[model samples]
Target: MRPAAGKTATLFKDTPLALDGGAMLSPVTVGYETYGTLNGARSNAILICHALTGDQYVASDHPITGKPGWWERIVGPGKLIDTDRYFVICSNVLGSCLGTTGPWEENPATGKPWGTDFPVITIRDMVRVQAALLDHLNVESLMAVIGGSMGGMQVLEWIATYPDRLHAAVMLATAARHTAQNIAFHEVGRQAIMADPNWQDGRYYDTGARPEKGLAVARMTAHITYLSEDALTAKFGRNLQGREAVSFGFDADFQVESYLRHQGSTFVDRFDANSYLYVTRALDYLDIAGRHGGRLSDAFKGASHVRCCVISFTSDWLYPTIENKRIVHALNAAGVPVSFAEIEAAHGHDSFLLDVPEMDHMLKGFIAAAARTRGLTGGTGA
Candidate 1:
């Protein structure tokens, strides 16, 4: 039952989706992409959740940027989450601007973009939407759910909300809840966007204007958090930007500054400022433990039968190994079969997206091991 390659599933059309903020959202559209076949038993499905800025293009070309999908290296015909033997699914999550219901989308009530009016969404809400997407596709269960960073938050939510819907989960560089530093960084980004006069309280869509400067600054700031000091040193260091000496001006004097400015400029081209605010706020509000009486273990009460593999990088202070350990501890308290790995890498929080041989090998081995247990074929992953 391999569905069409690109499809968007509509849900909450008749029944409004109950949000954590007590507001109901109707006519939620989920944009998604599928690869390979669902297999005879419908037991070969693998859901790949994307990070904050990612969309539905997992193993294909991005429509907006015309660049290869973010995870093309790890997800393809022979990649780690190989599309050859597994049916792969990836969706643009709610509160995201990429072909999904988000702040930039129109609100039926006011006939304008939701903007700041969009109800605050949480990780659980995002997971619920994905579950609905699967239901609409008639997929009862998934062989494995995989993600990293914010995507990993959704993976953890899946374990809490629909334990029986998936057999295994691979969580990388994430935590069960948002740390103070996480919220702080997100708040800074939000402040930067809101400070721009062009933002106009997120109502610039009609005026044909955008908060490009603010959004670019926000992206520049957040991009720093995604990397490590060691990686930064190795990549750029104190190298001057196309000059032998200092500029003695505000221009990019160092190569790192130039690179960051380039990153900021390019990011604003494909992302919406309002959507950035909503998504970051959603991530900051992710507190599975607080939702379950402040006990992280309580969130996994019904996930005893689920298998989990948690991985973290040594240089990833944004979502450090300590955070992953806390999750492993909670899963252990819940008697869930879980494996944890701490890879030594200098790429920081973004290590999972880079070409780290150890991560590639680990994912290939872990996916293969899970596939074997589920009676699925296995082959070498890229």
Candidate 2:
């Protein structure tokens, strides 16, 4: 579906945005959406960083899927994030295919899609682009920044690179670095995309054919990591798909196989194959500790004043409770004020995206206290 008018705003700048790959990206374009009002003091603005596949539709109906926004449950007039009390902004990241510039965009010099020629980007690069966007919006400092998974990675980069600009941060289901197993899983997805006949070395744009099959496999593989084994088992246990008995063939006879197929097929409709490769590569390179003298505590040393809330799900093996605790430990060592929670959940890393009563309440309380401190509510707001 075509994008609805006014749902998103794109910012274009002719100045150069220095990339970590030692290249200069000029004429940068970012797609973003904002809700509620930026109060007179502009002290109530919150930034919501999206996950790997999310876009700028934080609390609105998505243009493509016609579904409610990804975080609709927690971000609305009377919800936890409370749009009535705070202005919220969300943007498509640097290498995203949504409204942001990415490998899928046309190159002015070559007059062709950038494809694989797009500069390799890091989480820091993505955060840098976002900082530029904030500058354009005249938002000097944020009241709070909230994110999950890959979104959480960007939050870490923000605290590291621009500590003074952040007031509070919320990190959920993420890690200080990608483990070897994480890299291995992403590598499998990357190889699947490259092995597709239609990939054409990432130059398939003009051919009118795409690596949908390969991209689907990649999405399917990554989706597994977002979920827990117990959740999968409980949802589709020994169940057959549209049949009374197993087909005994290679076809998708099981319900779980059919579910994965659906997830893969639908994903390619809105995501680009090359963007997948680039974003996954960026995730593999995430190392908050490595970038700061081989110690995670050093990563947050500059952000001692920033209030932080770190949360993890018990079932999230992708970036388990242990990984999240490491973040809390680092913050503690750095003398940063932080609260940690390991919510008892069975849905795994994706739990942050779902309805969890404890998470919702915890976030509400934390954000409310932060808002009060920022003079955005009660007598202070008046």
Candidate 3:
């Protein structure tokens, strides 16, 4: 479905901003939706950053897929995000295709789609554009910045780049830097996209030749990381798809194979393959600590005004609990007020996007506590 005429007003209001990566982007737009009221002071603002492949439709139904927003379970009128109590804003990141500046956007210079011309973007570049958007909205500071996965990386960047701009931060199931193994997975996805003949070197716009197979394979590979081995085993195991026994053929004889195929096919419908390449590359290039002399604590140094909460899921093997622990240790060493929790869940890395009772409770408590500390409500002095 196409977006309404005014649906993307805020996102597309501004023109493309040049990036530090030496790329000129035009007609750059961000797709976002806001919830609740900003209040008289505008101090009740909460920014929600989305993970890779996630768009700005956090609480509302998605425009493209017609499915409920990715985090609708946790971000609604009375949900954990509590739109009734705070103004919440979520936007598609710079390198995304969901109404954001990306490979799919029209290039003014050549009067064509950017495609491969869309220069490589870093996570920091994404944050820079987000800051510009917030500035355009006249939001001088934020009550809290919350995110998971790549979203979590942006949350860290916000605090590090704009230390005095946020009152609190909540990062869930994320890491400070991309590991070599993570980069390898991303490389595999990129290779899959490039290997497809239909990709046509990223210029298949008018050829009606989309790299669907390649994009699907890439999505399938990445989806596996979002799930745990145990979860996969329990869900599919050695079961066959609708057959009592294996077909003994190369087709999707296994239940797991069928499930992954479904995932890939549906993903390509809503996501652009080139955008996938750009966003995944951005994730691979993220390194918060590296910008701070390789000391994670240094990243938080002098940011005493911001309180932080780090959460990890036990089954999340992608980011893992140890990753969250390291972030907590760094925050503690920086003398920053922080809280850490390891919630027990069976959903693996994607648990943060799913419904987990303990996670909801923790978020409610953390946001409430952080708000009080920041003097958003009447409680102990912030």
Candidate 4:
């Protein structure tokens, strides 16, 4: 069960997908990467799910950005994830741009980009595809499943859909469902994309025009949510970018504006506009409770074998501590062993992506405990 020396393919030819909406998806593919060695018992497997705008390059360099993998700080040989002791596997979620099937992929039927034709997916569907990929990899069970943000949604879905398949779970900075406000913000981004004339009804490929402006605006809007008011104020509040005074024109007169603009511009180069629409739509549609008769506890009722750790940040208004508490409460009622932590941090939803010493300590301890309970060795400290 060890990973090969070089990159390998996990997708099969013309895979069939049974959609929740009763539609059929032919020729499905998933992009993924594996690191470390699975022991003879195959009991050391860990799955890492990525958030929105994240790819499968968990410990390697990003092919497009030419930067270190997004989670390299927390993963690798001796990092928090400890690839030396755990066989870690990460996959680009279904409906993503990085080598997974999405709007950017060509539609076999029309021989054009799927674009608007791409079927709307749910978190459950994404997990389903991941489960299939795991099957392809010959992994019968997982030691743990860990993720944050949209990745966290996948983590929750993993536990619900395959309760007995994983020994433990780690969910960070996420929610069981999208709130009305969350949907509203995602709609704003979708509107921005559609408003761009270059979008061309989502058939922009033939036109050779990219909705860079609109997509950048969308990225700017979402990036704001990834930070806290305090962070924004501390980083750039009323400050001008290389200018002593604010410009009277509508151009970026403030440092914050300039920073956001840069973020948006850089994002478009590596991301596809239509993929943003599809992935955000999946996030908006995520609701494990709604699918389980409006009770969050019911979703985990059968997941008694799972030991879970739920982490939240103090300043994360988007999927705040209260939301995570609700999840913990549900796990408690379901009689699942769980640990809940609301760490003190000023970084908001992005804290999980940053190097928070407290979070690192908590995760190291929790993961070690979970591994010990599952009869694995080589435990690390808090």
Give me the overall lDDT of model 2.
Answer: 0.88
lDDT of 4 by residue, 280-304 (tens): 9989988888988988889998898
lDDT, candidate 1, 33-107, per-residue tens: 999888898999999999989888999988777899999998888667778888999999898877778888889
**Candidate closest to the true structure, highest lDDT:** 1
Candidate 3's C-alpha runs over 4 A off are: 1-6, 9-18, 24-27, 378-382
TM-score of 4: 0.96
Model 4, CA-based lDDT: 0.86
Candidate 3, run of 10 with poorest lDDT: 1-10
Candidate 2 worst ten-residue window by lDDT = 1-10
List per-prediction Cα lDDT, in the order shown: 0.89, 0.88, 0.84, 0.86
List ranges where model 1 is wrong by over 4 Å. 1-6, 378-382
What are the runs in model 2 whose C-alpha is more than 4 Å off? 1-14, 379-382
TM-score of 3: 0.94
**1 against 3, candidate with superior TM-score:** 1
In Å, residue 150's CA in model 1 sits off its true spot by 0.2
Ranking by lDDT: 1, 2, 4, 3
Estimated TM-score for each candidate: 0.97, 0.96, 0.94, 0.96
